[model samples]
Each structure stands twice: as structure tokens, then as C-alpha cells.
Target: MRPTVLITGASTGLGLAIAKRLLETERYHLVLTARESSLERFAEAGLAPSEHVWLRPLDVTIPSEREEVIDEIEREGTGLDVLINNAGVSYRAVVEDVTEPHRLAQMDINFRSPMELARLALPGMRSRRRGRIINISSVGGMMAMPTMAVYSASKFALEGACEALWYEVRPWNIHVSLVEPGFINSDGFERVRWTELAHLALDRPSHPYHRHYHDMTDFIARVMHNARPTPESVARTVQRTIERRRPPLRVPGTPDAYLFDLMRRFLPRRLYHELLYRSLPHIRTWGPQAQPVMRMAPRAMR
Candidate 1:
């Protein structure tokens, strides 16, 4: 029997690309899921149905929907061999500007939902004594940045949990991997939510951090555009991780991701902080500017 793999948030970006890539392999039966609107968008993109690919509408944040989907999988006796938790959301704002609702929403989708899904899938995987779990994380998980506290916190929590789970499940031959990607050309940014206070603050010229916020946003856009790492690249990494007998615990999904991971691991805290601040246009200007000084010849020589 062909192995069965289920991917959440499979309507667009990395998740969608992963589903397509796995389908091409013809090694596993693919299950792709997204919200109803996302599913419609996927269909509109001309992804026709096939015997091997099953598309389902799923809102990962909803508990009932999650349980129903898992129940269906169990009833079908497909016995999931791989579970890819890729559904997530992000927002940019300082803690003072973030709303309670927005913070919780990020937590629900990025951290809680994925954990819950894993809880449901664990029993079957443990029974089978073999499986793969891949969590789509972010470089932010390793290195937190301004205006990304909530998003980074969610991912950090996920990374910690998955890392521990990795060791726990290894005896059963279950491999857990975290795929951390830097800025990729994806719909994730387009879908980013701005807290109400952040939105209002950004619009106000009197706001202390308004200009900094604008510059940061622009910088991120430029970086993502220039780097241009496609979702296919991430999917390829995920595919390989799933195929390997003893896959790496963490996989960097892009070149930038690899670099950042290295810096996080080996760079001195002070030096790393300096480099990171210098890279951000907004933060770089926060310090005193160096005045140019022309040196005259020594008085005796002159």
C-alpha cells in the first residue's frame, strides 16, 4: 500500500507547493487541506482532482474540524505515514501595539493548532511504529526581531516542543523535523495581520516609531523580493527530509535560512546583536551618526 501523507494549509505558498511536489513523486497518497476560500482559490488555479490527490477544506484552528478530519482518516484506514503542519499566520507589531485578540489568533494557528493535530495523529503513528512529522517554522524562531515578538514566540514554542518530541518518538522510528525558512516569495506576507493599534500608530506622523515601522516593512519586502526563494525549494527540502531514514532534526529551507541558523549558533551575542541591528535600516539609525573628520598632516610636517 502506498504511504499516506496529509498537509495542512495546502492551498497556497509552501504548503501547496509541497502537496504538488509529493504528488509528482507518486510514492505516497497525498491529502491536501485549506480553508474553504483557499480551496476555491486552489481549484481556480487549475489544480484538477486526481485519484492520488485528495483535496479537503479544513480550518486548522477549529477543534471540531480537526477532530473530524482525523476521524475520517482513521475510519478510512489509510493510516497516515506523514503529517506536515504548515498552516500558520503572522503579524508585525510591538507588544504595546498588539491587541489581545491578534496575539491569541497567532498563537492558535501557529502553535496550538499544529500541536493538537499532532496529538491526534500520534496514536496511529505510534501504533504503526513508523512515521514522519514535519513542522514548518521560521528563521524568526531562532532569532527574534523587532515587531515580530508574537510570531516568533509561537514558532519558538513550536520548535521547543517538536525538538523534545523528536527524541521521544525516535524509539518508535518516528522522525520529527522542523523546516525553518527565511523570507520566501509567498502569500504569507500578503495575509499578514496588523494590530489595530499598530495600524493606527503607523498612520500617525506623531507616533514615535512610525517611520521606523514603515522602513522595516519596506526592508522586509525588498529582502523577500531580492532573495526570491520559491516555495518549491522549501517543498524539495521537506520531501528529502521525509525520504531520509535518519533525517536531520532541523532543516533550513533557504540559503538565507542556513546563514541565519549558522549565525544564531556560532556568533557572539553582542556581535550578533550589532550585525542584526545594522542590517535593519530603522534600527541602524537609532544610534549617533559618525561624523566625518579630515586629518591634517602633523603640525611639524605641515
Candidate 2:
């Protein structure tokens, strides 16, 4: 029997790429879920629904919908061999500026939903004594950044949970792994929800960080343009993880991901902070402007 794999958020971006790569292997049956409209779009894009691939509508934040999907999987007798928790959303804003609702929304989709789905799928996997649970995390989970605090927090939560679960399920022959990718060129950026507070602040020049907001956004755009990895690369990482009998608990989705992880592990706290800050075009340029004021201060002040 072909291994059955279920991937959430499979209509576009990395999820879609993973589905395509896995289908090409012709080694596993795929169960893909997305919003209804995205399912239509996927079909229109030539990945039309078929027997080997099961397409279903899913709003991961909804418990009832998740239950329905799990029930269907059981009814079909396609006991899941792999569960890819790829469904996630981002909310970009400073920690202080992020509203309660936006923070909760990020946690709900990125952390809570995946955990719930994993819980539902574990029983079957335990019974079979073999399975894979791949959690799609981000480098932000390892190292948080400005304007990404809330988003990173959710991924961090996921990493911690998955890591603990890995130990607990090892005896059952169930493997849990985290796929951490750096910036990826995908529809994810377009889907990001900027907090209302951040938006309002950007509209007002008098706001303390108004200039910084535009500067950061522009700097991020440049970085993404120059370094963003392809979704296919991430998909390939996922495929490899599934094939390996004893894969590492954490895997980098791209070469740059490996570099970033190394830096985080080896660099000194102060030096790392300085290097990270200077890497931003806005911060580097702004530093020189502040030097003159510092030089002009009274000798006692200096």
C-alpha cells in the first residue's frame, strides 16, 4: 500500500509545491486541504482533483472542520503515514502595537490548529507503529525579529511543542520533525496581516517610529528580493525528511537556512545583535546621522 500523506494549506506557495513534488514521486497518496476558493484555483491551475489526490476544504482554525477531515480519512481507511502541518499565517507588527485579536489569530492558525490536527492523527499512527509529523516552522522560531514578534512567538511555541512530542512518540516509531526555512519567495508575504496600530502609525509622520516603519519595510523587501529561497526547495526538504528512516529533529529548508542557524548558534550575543542591526539598510544609514549629535554633545555628557 502506498503511504498516505496529508498536507494542510496545499492550495498555494510552499504547501502547493510540496504536494507537486510528492505527487511526482508516485510513491505516496496525497490528502490536500485548503479553503474552498483555493481548491477551485488549484483545479484551474491543472492540479485537478483525482483518485490518488484527495482535495478537501479546510479552515484549520475551526475544530469541527478538522474533526470532519480526520473522520473522512478514517472512513476511507487511508491510515495516515505522514502529516504535514503547513497551514500558517503571519501578522507583522511590534509587540506593543499588536492587538489582542491579531495575536490570538496568529496563535490560533499557526500553533493551536497544528497541535489539534496532530493529536487527531496520532492515534492511527500509534496503532500502526510508524508515521511522520512534519511541522513547518521558520528561522524566526529560532531567532525573533522586529515587526515579527507575534508571528515568531507562534512558531517558537510550535517548535517547543513538536520537540517535546518527538521524544514522547519515539517509542511508537513516530517521527516528529521541524522544517525551518528562512525567507521564501511565496504568496505568504502578500497574505501577511499588518496590525491596524502599525498601519495607523505609518499614516502619521509625527509617530515616533513612522520613518522606521517605511525603512524596515523597504529593507525587508530588498532582503527578500536578494535572498528569498524558492518554495520548491522547501518542498524538496520535506520530501527528503519523509524518505529518511531516522531524519534529524530539525532540518533547514535551504542553504541560507543552514548559515543562519550556524550564526545563531556560534555568534556572540553583542556581536550578533550588532551584525543583525547593521544588516538593515535603514539602521546602517541612520547610525551615521546620529554620530554627529553624539559628537556635538558636551564633554561631560559624552
Candidate 3:
């Protein structure tokens, strides 16, 4: 029997790419879950689930929907061999610009849902003494950046939880891996979920930190205009992680992801911050008197 793999946010972006890659191999039975709108978009794009694939609309943030997915997985003959927590959103703005509800929503989709899914899936993994939990984190997970405060916080929380889970479940042969990718390109930058308040602030130049927000948005647009390391490549990393004898605790999905991780671990703090600030040149536009500084921001490290 083929291994059963469950992927959240499976309708688009990295999730869709991962699903297609696995479908090509025909090595695994896939459970692809995403929000209804995303699934509709998937269908509109001319793709549908095959015999080996089970597609469903699931908002992982909802406790009942998450439980339902686990229950279904438990009933399957193969049970669950892998769980990919790929559902996530990034809110663009300064810390203050994000409303409290939006702040919580970012955490809910990115950090809380993944953590809870792991908690639900672990019992089954432990009972069987085998399973793989792969989280689709980001380069921001390794280090924080300007205008990404809340998003970074969410990933940071996930990274810490998964790291601890790695040590605790090593004895059970339950492999946990964090797949960190850098800036991923999307259609109209759908992945960059700018908060409503932040959007409004863009037109109001009088708004405090307006320069910071616009500069950051322009920076993201510029970088994403030429974003590399396709989603399919990152998806392949997820598949490879599952097939490993002892899946690595952390898998940097792109070259920049690896660079960021290593630099943070080895580089001196002052030097690192200098590089960080230099790369995020818009961050220098903190004060009203500061002019927008736009050069080739750090391309590789994201």
C-alpha cells in the first residue's frame, strides 16, 4: 500500500506544487486540504484530484475541521505516514500598523494550526512508531526582519515548537522537519497578505511610518519580481525529507535559506545586523526626515 500523506493548504502555491510532484511519482496516497476559495481556485485552474488523491476544504484553524481530518486519516488503512503543515499567511506592515485581530489571524494560520495538527497527528505517529511531520516555514523563521514583525513571530514560535518536538520524538522514530524557503513568488503576490489597515495606510502619507510601509512594499514587489527557487523545488525537498533514513530536523529549502541559517549561527551579531539593515534598506527610512533608499537589496538571503 502507498504511504498516506496529509497536506494542509494543498490547493495552491507550495502545497499545490508538492501535490503535483507526489502525484507524478504515484508513490503516495495524498490528502489535500485547503480553504474552499483556494480549492475553487484550484479547480478554476483546471486541476482536480485523481483516484489516489483526496481533496477537501479544511480550515486548519478550526478545531472541528482539524479533528475531522485526523479522524479520517486514522480510519484509512495505511493510516498517516506524513503530515505537511503548509497553510500560512504573511501580514505586511510595522508591528503597530497591524490590528489585534489581524495579528492573531497571522499567528493562528501560521503557528497555531501547525502546532495543533502536530499534536493531533503525533499520537498516531507514536503508536505506529513511524511518521513524518514537515512544516513549511520561511527564511524569516531563522531570523527577524523589518515590516515582518508578526509574521516572523509566528514562524519563530513554530520553529521553537518543532525543534523541541524533534528531540522528544526521536526515540519513537517520528521524524519532524522544518522546511524553510525564502521569498516565494505568487500571482499578484497573493502570499503577501497585507493587513487591511496597512493597505489604507499606504494612501495616507500622513500616517506615521508611511515611508516604512511603502518602502517595504516596494522592496517586496521588486524582489518577488524575480523570485527564484520555484515552489516545485521546495516541494521536492519535502518529499526527500520524508524518504530520508533519519529525516533532518531542519531542511533549508533554498540556497538563501541555507545562507541565512548559517550566517545567523556563525556570524557576529554586529556584522549580521549590518547586513540585515543594509539588505532591508527601507528600514533605514524610520524617521520622517529619512529619504527612501532603494538599491539592490539583499537578493539571495531574502
Evaluated with lDDT, which candidate comes out highest?
2
Q: Return the lDDT, model 2, position 217.
A: 61
For candidate 1, the per-residue lDDT at 4 reads 86
lDDT, model 2: 0.83
Q: Which segments of model 3 are wrong by more than 4 Å?
A: 282-285, 291-302
CA lDDT of each candidate?
0.82, 0.83, 0.82
**For each candidate, what TM-score against the reference?**
0.92, 0.91, 0.91
lDDT tens digits, residue span 37-82, model 2 = 6788677646867788888998898898898888888778578889
Ten residues in a row with the worst lDDT in model 1? 293-302
lDDT of 3 at 235: 86
Q: RMSD of model 1, in Å?
A: 9.3
Question: Each candidate: RMSD to true structure?
Answer: 9.3, 7.0, 4.0
lDDT of 1 by residue, 50-75 (tens): 77777887899988888888887778
Candidate scoring better on TM-score of 1 and 3? 1
**Clash pairs of candidate 2?**
none
